[model samples]
Target: MTTKRKPELVAYTVTGEGEKAYWTRIGSAWAHKDGEGFNLDLAALPVNGRIVLMQPKPEGDAA
Candidate 1:
């Protein structure tokens, strides 16, 4: 017999300007994506995990 575990809740949002990504909660054990909607295996991430939108830094701010 197989048993399914309840998914833990985690909050995340989208990155780019494509879809309207509201602050939503998802299971910790579920594979989630960052703001770019990229595929990320966040099954081991904490509930407060934050995925930042990695865009090219500005020329002056490229430190």
Candidate 2:
């Protein structure tokens, strides 16, 4: 009996000095059942940047 991993939309942004300053959708996140941590399924990790994980924003919550 195996449980499926819940995937959450994760966003990656290039920041800091000497790195590409841009924001884009990088990949999906499979969170653990315990709500402690998760894993990312990225197409390719940016050479220089930062990675941020969060649940997908609601369509009506756009600012």
Candidate 3:
């Protein structure tokens, strides 16, 4: 058995063409113990530059 913690990073959509560009929250990630890479939890990875890793936005800023 194991426990879960707050996500270390978030995944989102930031890829597409001109008018098609859009943003959407997709998943989260956790830093690996080795500090080499991350353990990802994603809905689905995009083919292009469709996903990016970013810190969670500050609370109460906006939705």
Q: Largest TM-score belongs to which candidate? A: 3
Better of 2 and 3 by lDDT: 3
Query: Which pairs clash inside model 2?
Result: none
- lDDT for each candidate structure: 0.36, 0.65, 0.78
How well is each residue in 20-55 modelled by candidate 1, as lDDT tens digits? 544432323322345433233242333455543333
Can you rank all candidates by TM-score, best first?
A: 3, 2, 1
Clash totals for all candidate models: 2, 0, 0
TM-score of 3: 0.66
lDDT of 3 by residue, 1-63 (tens): 133877889898777767886778888989888999988888777766568888987778773
Candidate number with the higher TM-score (1 or 2): 2
The lDDT of model 1 is: 0.36
Q: If scored against the real structure, what TM-score would every candidate get?
A: 0.21, 0.54, 0.66
Q: After superposition, how far is residue 27 of candidate 3 from its true place, in Å?
A: 0.6
Residue 40 in candidate 3, Cα distance off native in Å? 0.8
Model 1 — which ten-residue stretch has the worst lDDT? 1-10
